[model samples]
Target: MIRSYEKTDLEEMVRIWYEASVIAHFFIPASFWASQKSTMKEKYLPLAENFIFEEEGQISGFISLVGEHVCALFIAPEMQGRGIGRALLEHAKTLKGKLSLKVYKENERAFHFYKKCGFVAASEEVDEYTGCVQILMEWEQVR
Candidate 1:
C-alpha cells in the first residue's frame, strides 16, 4: 500500500535511502552516504513532499518531491524489484502531473528505469559535490 508520509516514517525512510543509495551508487564511497543520513532526515525529508510505500505496517520505500523536481526515490535493498519504487513514482505523478529529476549517469539501473517510465533525458551536468555526471530527465503527464 502507498500513502502520504507521516512524521513517524522519517527514520525508516532515511534508512532505506542510505541503504539503497549505497547499493545503487557503489562507485561512491559509503562514507559519503552515511554522512548524509542526518541531512536526509532533517533537511530533505522535511522539506519535500514525501510519499511512502508500506506493506504489513512497515515502510519499505519512499519518494520525495520538491515542487516539480523529484528529489529522491529509494527502496530498501531487499525490497527492490517488487515495483515499490515504481508505485511511489506513479503516486508522485498524480500529485504533480509533471516531474523533473537528475540521475547519476553511472547508475544505469535508475537511468533505464526512468526511461522505461517515460522520462526523457534532457541533458547532462557535472555534480560538483561528487564529481559525477548527472543526467537531467523530465516527464509530462499526457493530456
Candidate 2:
C-alpha cells in the first residue's frame, strides 16, 4: 500500500536506492552508485514532500515526489516489474500540475516506461556525474 514516508523508513529507502543503482550498473558503472546515493539524498530527498509505495509490511519499494517532479521511484531488486512504479507515477499525476523527471539515456527501461506513461521527451542533456546523456521527460495534465 502507498503512504507517506516516515523517518523510520529511511534505511529501507536507502537500501532500495542501492539495489536499484546496482541493477542500473548493467549499463553504467558500479562506482556510480555511490555518487547517485549522495545525489539522491542531497539534491532530491530534501525537496521531496511525499514518498510512498507497496511494502510487504517491511518497506520494500518506494516512490518519492518533489512538487510535481518524480524525484525517485525504486523497487527492491526482488520486487520490481510488479506495477509499483507505474502506480506511483499514476498517483503523481493527481497532483497540481505538469510532472517532469530526468532519466539517464542509458536507462532505457525507465525512458520507455515514462514514454509509455505518456510523458514526452522534453529535453536532453549530459549528466555531470556519470557523463551520460540524460533525457528530461514531462507529462502535463490538461485542465
The true-versus-predicted C-alpha distance at residue 43 of model 1, in Å, is 0.8
In the predicted model 2, the residue pairs found to clash are none
> 70-92 in candidate 2: lDDT tens per residue?
77888888878888888877877
Any idea how many clashes model 2 has?
Answer: 0
Q: Candidate 2: which stretches are off by over 4 Å?
A: 35-43
Candidate 2: C-alpha lDDT: 0.79
- What are the runs in model 1 whose C-alpha is more than 4 Å off? none
What do the candidate models score in CA lDDT, each in turn? Answer: 0.93, 0.79
Error of 2 at 96 (Å): 3.1
For residue 74, give model 2's deviation from the true position in Å. 1.0
lDDT of 2 at 2: 77
Name the candidate that leads on lDDT.
1
